[model samples]
Target: MSIEHDAHASGRPAITEGGPSLPQERRLVTAIPGPRSQEMFARKRSAVPPGIGTTLPVFVTHAGGGVVVDADGNSLIDFGSGIAVTTVGNAAPRVVERVRRQVGDFTHTCFMVTPYESYVEVCEKLNALTPGDHEKRSFLVNSGAEAVENAVKVARHATGRQAVVVFDHGYHGRTLLTMTLTAKNMPYKQGFGPYAPEVYRMPMAYPFRWPGGAENCAAEALAQVTDAIDKQIGAHNVAAIVIEPIQGEGGFIEPARGFLPGLLEYARANGIVFVADEVQTGFARTGHLFACEDEGLVPDIICTAKGIAGGLPLAAVTGRAELLDAVHVGGLGGTYGGNPLACEAALAVLETIEADGLVERARRIGDLMLPRLRALAERFDVVGDVRGRGAMTAIELVVPGSAEPDAAVTGEVARRCHAEGLLVLTAGTYGNVLRFLPPLSISDALVDEGLSILEKAISSV
Candidate 1:
């Protein structure tokens, strides 16, 4: 397929094709999971374990800008971006070129075994690009869970404390420690037992679900969190307070204004490390390079992944030199932590974000999505709330005339969208939120079309 470099007025190349120049428009040649997909799915069921669940079982053969082509040749508009891992889009030109070059040079030398310059370069980029201007150091990992675990390890080593604090509805990762840090119990922590020790959870400043009301959420939540830390787990004993600026899996809940700043002040005064898990909100996905930037929050440590390497399995923990370096030598690292290929792809991804002005693009996406979603909320009583920042937006479904969560309606709306060739995702602690994470490279026309499909789906439901 011939790739064209059609630059927009903003100097960013407008991606109008999927892999092999697959047309950007949605095309349903067969029912979602056609015969071929069904066959493949049957094979997958036989080969893979039941623990691994799939949202849509269609077998994808190719994907790019804003669509994934299935094995049956059906083209579906992609709103999930593989859970915010492809901010620059799948098969992004820069990422592809860099990976190609790096693969030809050498695949992996194992950074721990033989350190490489690409790893150093990636860390340098992270230290320079992360929110603060302080002297920072970073270490790479293979996934968000690893990064979160390492962050906690560093915090403990630096502070000599065992207690780690997290917030309600926050998701860190799936590792042993991260799972303990996570708030949700079902599906994620149901069968898993013997979770990590000394992990404490506090109330989050969730505006829509606050006890009194949205207006009083921030102050109450701050007070509750402070009390929880002071009374439940003494402040001096706490090593770190980890949180997601904009909760991802727990719904795209943006904390009430002033809430994050208050927590930062408390953590600072008490000498506890304030860690922001930006796994899903980092890179240009949240308007700012990091969601904490919205409140000028400079966390002691920031765990980043998802959109870091254009869909590659890469993660990083960027933090102050004193905190990150406090760990003894050889205390942090993994075999595939900073694979050369992923490092190269990350460098390219960073370049793409800057050159494409994707941060502004994310804000533009939010401008287009929020009003429409809010309008839906106005029309449908089931849509209890619509919230999020930049391209990461969501609508929480609830029983009409009540705040009771309506997970059934959420599922129905998502199913309807899938049937119509739109790929949306569901989230939230109660499974009542419909989240949208569209690729920044997707065209406005495609976005409008997707929204139109979503409207019909919601109306039908």
Candidate 2:
């Protein structure tokens, strides 16, 4: 059921006279995981596997703006937009309208079995909206990992090389190939090996945790990467260099300046394709449409998903025409790869972003979040570092007077927030980075209030 708005907000949600609307306020009416949620969770414990994790055990009944109303009737302030999937907000008016119409018209014909105009139009949109202006082509998939795997296929097919380079602290996805591409070991890749072959790991230019110093991160990391490729794998044998412009699951780690451009130059010189895995940082979630745009990067291939379709499962691999076209017919696709409903949702999402100036909105979110978090850093000894851009901001928690991560404290802080009706998330190699991804539809008042809750949570912890 699509909820209508009061029509008075800045994001300008589609208004209707009467409906059960989501109020943009944080209200706690019961315990975090109150009786009703506990009942559902007990059933989940019996039916669901332990492998599937839950960030907050509170089951949601409805969500919109900056609020997620759980089964217990608790309205929690949303700082995590369903892991950055709902950039336009959950049940967005545009997405709801388009998807509802698409569902009525046709659910699925399978793009491969029967062609559709929406798929072709989405590809065209990807070509125009992505960082490159070069002639390009795109194919859709069901998730980010699938898009990445296809991108690698395109790279290998075009270049006739097998070696693919990935960075430390990078996360591609959970599928077999992408799990192998991911850097974390415990949750994502522990028992999933023997992993994909010919995938190499490179040191990230993570300024805060860089070995030598922040100032030397760019040059040294680039040098180390080039040296690693030349000696370990041989540049001529490499097919693609894949990276997250701003490392997502890896602590929102923004590489130091000059690192990405240097890598691109090296790849171009070495005949290797550059693939930017913009799964989390694309679609105006970052201040720019793509985070790579911050450095004027033009990747040979770019993958996007998270915020693409306003919560629908959709991902795309957009790259140079020569590369994607190099694959033989039927090399890339899935049954639900550009499902009409998801395609319509993606189109509507793009429309919302452009119309609402979400790119600027993302910048404003960053402007609102970074300062408050930095202020927290000043006052709290547990805060090791504060970083991120646009709506994707986070703080690294560490033991006072040392760089060692305080995962225990991080967990406690997150628990405190959840208990108080504020939904937050944790990440990082050490599990100490507290991340925030407020919806672009979130109001200034909600953002301020959420940050207040965050501050209180941190202080109490």
Candidate 3:
């Protein structure tokens, strides 16, 4: 049989922001919710819990560089990157090999009981790599929420304080404390209340909705934070102020220029431990290694996860040695905190990032995605704001001429894209933002292909 190839096709370019090229041309030969996937879904709806089924309804069978192949055999260009969990790329060769080797040797020894070299190595790397040249220490955990909780523990222990401050629209995790830290209330936090006490909510810099320039927005938010701390919850009682440098679940809400600097100053003056939650923005997803680096702000504590181990469940809190040491022995640790297999994967992930120049690649990908998204925003009145850093980005949807969100239309666009074989994620407190998390290693052609599908979806909207 003769093989067919596209005229525009070239050999898969290394470190491309272009898009993905399969070994062969991509062909969606069946309906998106193909027979196989539908059958599986039927069986899943019967056997699996109600919460397990996908909101998009397409059941993925396999995923690689920049595409997801569903059980129905429909090939889709992946723009969500598994919700930013596969930044280096799905099934990265290095991470896969490391996992295989580690699993063969040992899966878990429970680092808390029997420490391993890989765990210490991963922590050492984190301590050295995280911002702040000053002596630092690291503690590993099983998930982002766990990492955030532990950061709070360390801050409280160091400061002998109880209150923690978080901003609106920031997402932490599903666990009790993190759910409380998270901003949105409906699904994640609804009916799960009587949450951990001493947690306070503050306003984040949302320039698109805020009526002013970047400087003015920052000033307003800073003033609000000051008053909140003074009247509602005094800074003297606060342990830490946790923030997402670029608010992830908060509609990719980027803190106004100088806003982060002002928060740092306030934290310093008030003796508050400033925690930068980079779980969604770390590991070069924001062009720089960490979003905080953009402002040269050295957070007292930093929480990271999601993309650290390629895809494995791993999270960490890296902070000043003195602060971390303040926690009593046995204060921070989990049974699978630094599993050997996950640590091995993490090591490989760091290596792949450096060797592949993914940090720089993320920035280039951002440069490419921004213009296309901005163009869409310009054309569509529903497209309210396009914002983000590096490859981490989003397009907020709104009703024409009003800041009022248009989640219904955003959801419709995503549903349409799924039918057209593109995978994207919806975010924001109101669920009105479409965030993009394409793999850093994706090719330009694939990027354009996905964008074309997106353009078509928006046009239909």
lDDT of 1 by residue, 2-98 (tens): 1123443433335433333668889999998899999999999999998999999999999887789999999999999999999888888888889
Quote the positional error of residue 271 for candidate 1 in Å: 0.4
lDDT values for all models: 0.90, 0.90, 0.85
| Model 3: per-residue Cα lDDT over 123-235, one tens digit each | 89998888889899998898988999899999999999999999988999989999999989877887988999999999888888776655589999889988989899898
- For model 2, residues 206-284, the per-residue Cα lDDT tens digits are 9988889999999999999999999999999999999999999999999999999999999999999999999999999
Work out how many backbone clashes candidate 3 has: 7
Better of 2 and 3 by lDDT: 2
Pairs in steric clash, model 1: none
- Comparing 2 and 3 on TM-score, the stronger one: 2
As a whole number from 0 to 100, the lDDT of residue 416 in candidate 1 is: 93
Global CA lDDT of candidate 2, please? 0.90
Instruction: Give me candidate 1's TM-score against the actual structure.
Output: 0.97
Please report how far candidate 2 places residue 127 from its true position, in Å. Answer: 0.6
Q: Candidate 2: list runs displaced more than 4 Å.
A: 1-20
TM-score of each model, paired residue for residue = 0.97, 0.96, 0.94
* lDDT for residue 344 in candidate 3, whole number 0-100: 95
Worst 10 residues of 1 by lDDT: 1-10
lDDT for 420 (candidate 3): 85
